[model samples]
Target: MAEGGEDPQRLKKIAAAAYDYDNDSRWTDYWSNILIPPHMASHAEVVEHYKRKFYQRYMDPDLVVEPMSSTSSSQSARPSASTTNANEQQARSRSSGSVPRTAGPSATTGAANPSSVRWDQQTIQFSVNAWVFVIAVLAVLPLVPKNLSNRAYRLSFMGTACSSLYSLYALYGRPRAWNMQGMQVYFQSIVGAKDFIYFIYCLTFVTSNLCLKFALIPILCRALEQVAKFLRRNFTRSTIYRKYLEDPCVWVESNTTTLNILSSQAEIAIGFLLIISLLSWQRNFIQTFMYWQLLKLMYQAPVTAGYHQSNWSKIGRTVNPMIQRYAPFLNTPVTAVQRWWFR
Candidate 1:
């Protein structure tokens, strides 16, 4: 103790704190390794300045509003006592270039993540939108006139593709769900969010091109009925997926018994029209297109089955490189461009 029970060591630390505040060189180094919080055990003034400023900029103000009094008609003209005191203190600290020795819990708690919570809400809504879209397409497709069903189906496919792509982009760019990693593994990643049933439903859109044979349409509907059952069982209970699957209007339910016959008939008619368009020369194009669609499905099947992107990449590495070499030339749009030049 130096004098009157004052500790000599604390005086030295207080001096060091002043030294730290004035010296820009040490302060720069202090910030370069900023992740390591300052040694405030000695009541570092330099650290305190920053800590107060941090709260001023980022802290949510704890406003205390008392019940209004009818006697005070000029209430709006005067600020609250707390606010006035806070402002006065803030001004004094700024003028003196010294922060008060207040290291309250609010200063250390940092900021709350309102944006993160909002994004989670957005992700839930996006999933709900996708679910609603597919259901709408299914319910309305049976009623669509045969003459316009082709265009209507194509529009439905395009709409779904856009929605899927948007969801994927949004999901990948930022993480929202606590258990989920990225959209690449969203539906299938058991280690992440096990939402595989939605992935299967998305695939059915791509496969609708193969909607041939009216008699087998009933069987396909039956299989999708099972898909609905599986989705309800596996996904409806989980917190992340329940918002999408179990929501009142968005809940995916179809009368498989009644709908199957109508759905099958629609498919038969669609198949007949498609078959009538297959000219002799177009047979090769049809075959090639089918092969292309199958190839695409092969690439996606593993992902749909729940493997992560890393695993799928490794699994396809052998064949993918070879296919890549010739894919550009064989691709339909590229070939069409080459043909147009000669014609």
Candidate 2:
């Protein structure tokens, strides 16, 4: 073969060798040692290298050498070329319209999933229980005696009063955090603001129901106890109808026992509400404090020195004043009578 004829073969061999060398070195040091630095060195140099490399590898050399008649080739290759081009176009269109696939259900079943469901169920059950408590308290109200001692009345009232206060606290204790002027701010500076607020709401709802339940019931129960005490006093004094009211032991015993049970129920309801409220408040305070700490960290940290503090000062300043105005409502008195009425 002529020297000129062997030129293309020799050039192809040289290109293949260079490609192999670059490809092998690519997995190790070639990218960091050569390509990356060149690209970072100068935009113009990078662009020139990219263009040269792209053309050398991708451009058809045969097109340059054999610039012949379009008519002759078109006649022979028309059908096959058209079919290939159509297939390529269809593949590209299909790929362009294809939607992406995701991972399995496990991806969505994190801590929040079951917790959210449980909360929902609890809320529903509690709502039903609250209504039942209210009905029970009401049913026992008219049976209480008016002449009962102050201590018995007070005990009954304490339960309902606490529930009312707890309900009120839950209703308005914590405001939702507002995201304003690109800053996230809590209404209350305490921890777990959201959870506390939710707990308070639930507790308040339950307590309110309890108050409605016991308000009349306890008063009536006290009255019954007073009647039994009066009957027992007369039974000891009289001799004629002594046998009729003589079972003072049974009447007195049952009345006192029933009163004790009702009073205990009231106490339990109040104590439970108070405990939940405290827990909610504690959780909210911790979460709020933590969020504030995080905000402070973001602001004070050296890494964030250049970060801008947005115009949230105006809104922040109003928060304290708002709390002050609502303080009276928040601190409203909870009387023993009111509490007993609820229980």
Task: Write the residue-wise lDDT of candidate 1 on 149-206 in tens digits.
Answer: 5554444444444544443433322222435453333333221211222333334444
- Which candidate's TM-score is highest? 1
Q: What lDDT tens digits, residue by residue, belong to model 2 across residues 1-343?
A: 1134556545643454354333332212212322333223354444334333322322312112221234433354544533432343343223223322332355354325534643554344344334434444444456655333222334344433344333333323322323562123222222223223223323432333222333344334443444454445345767753767567445554556545455434433433344454465333443333333433433333322123122124433654466557764533342442343234
Alpha-carbon lDDT of model 2: 0.37
Cα-lDDT of candidate 1: 0.40
What's the lDDT for residue 106 in model 2? 56
Model 1: lowest-lDDT 10 consecutive positions: 56-65
- Candidate 1 Cα misplacement greater than 4 A, ranges: 1-140, 174-301, 305-343
